[model samples]
Target: MTFKNAFMITLTAGSILASHLTQAGSPVHITVKNLSDQEMYYQSTSAMTQAHASPTPELLIKGKGSDEFRVTNPALPDVTTASLRYTIGNKTCEFRTSYIRTIAPGGLFSGKLNTAPKWDKKAISSGNATCTVTVTSTNFSDHSWSVVFTMK
Candidate 1:
């Protein structure tokens, strides 16, 4: 092959690789911690509608323990929020938060929390709940990310 042809082929290959890298998104690692004395249930059904990325299965977080899951290839500019529900006795309390935006590919992009989670006054609930949400860039090369939610 001519030198010119070889150079053109190398340039084309490099361009394709770069294009793929640019389109690549980071997988988000999600963790939910139940800091209260009672078990908590994380429902993704409602949040899934607004979520750009979310865990596939619903989670049950034990009291004073945590559960973890992952979301693959979250798109950039992710505006995902979390909704947590807890049942103590006959009363069930639910808390929803504002969107936590993550624009960067990778490091801590944004962290948000509602220390005093709003409870539905109309619902007959009995409990005090707090929620925290954090989004961080874990790896840059592969664009790995982490999203942590803590409930107390």
Candidate 2:
């Protein structure tokens, strides 16, 4: 075969393999990076179709840093629902989303929290397998905030 024809054949095979990998429900590696200047604490809960995994114990992430987690739980193969709770300084915020029907194999999901004022609330979901939350202010009475990401 000509070099050009051989290259096209290889490209088509790679595309088919990628599509099969996604449909097969392979693992997804998710990284949570702390882009804020303050120390941050967080916990994650993820749920899938047949089974549910317990929420992870609270963990700490320093500023300008990142941590990685694998979403390979077979029970939560689809990971239809997930939540993230994080604490920065004396304030805490949460990001939750549901109906996340599909996360491609070898998928990457990233999230960041903007520095807070007093209280802030927001959530963002990207079509490119990413999510983000930003909090500006919160109620002084309870010192609590809820930030929910709406899936796109």
Candidate 3:
């Protein structure tokens, strides 16, 4: 969530929630913080940018089969159900694959990635890709919430 703007850098965080319930009001509570060398102030982005980070429902697809992963309904509000894929090396293997159906504000969904995916370890040292969560349209949302995480 890092944005480059001269001497200042900004990081913004929001959540994505997908379920079969009703979306009453707003979905995400967003905040912007400025990390800069100079004493800079916080200025919000246009509604267009906010719309990008806002959470929406989509497919929990995975594996080479790309199946629809299921979860209990009526999931908590202000949360995200993310299907994360972490690769080991340049080859990009599917390490850990699951849905984090809840991401409360100021909280991190932490877990150990699959160091050894269902691949041949002896023959292959590592094969992996970036951690990307692609949102799919559900009965709730006509659109999808898609975001890409930059590998560090």
Best by TM-score: 1
Alpha-carbon runs more than 4 Å astray in model 3: 1-64, 71-75, 86-90, 93-133, 138-152
Question: Which tens-of-lDDT digit does each residue in 23-142 have in candidate 2?
Answer: 422233334556567677764434341133223323777776665543233333233334565666555555543322322343244453322223222353332323375332333332
In model 1, residue pairs whose N, Cα or C atoms come closer than 3 Å (at least 3 residues apart or on different chains), thus clashing, are 26-143, 107-137
TM-score attained by model 1: 0.45
TM-score of each: 0.45, 0.38, 0.21
Q: Candidate 1, residue 35: CA error in Å?
A: 0.6
Ranking by TM-score: 1, 2, 3
Q: What is candidate 1's lDDT per residue for 1-152, written digit by digit as tens?
A: 99999999999999987766555233456666677887677554465422533545345667788776654433332333434555544445554433333333333444633122111111123555455566543454444556666666
> In candidate 3, what are the lDDT values of residues 1-152, reduced to their tens digit?
33465224322212223322444222222111112222222122233222333342122212321222222213333333322232322433221112223323432445533221110101111333233332232223311132222221
Flag regions of model 2 displaced more than 4 Å: 1-26, 44-58, 76-80, 97-152
- Per-model CA lDDT versus the true structure: 0.51, 0.44, 0.25
Q: After TM-score superposition, what is the CA distance of residue 129 in candidate 3 from its true location, in Å?
A: 3.2
Task: Give RMSD (Å) of candidate 3 vs. truth.
Answer: 22.2
Model 3, position 1: C-alpha lDDT score: 35
RMSD of each: 10.8, 16.9, 22.2
lDDT of 2 at 150: 20
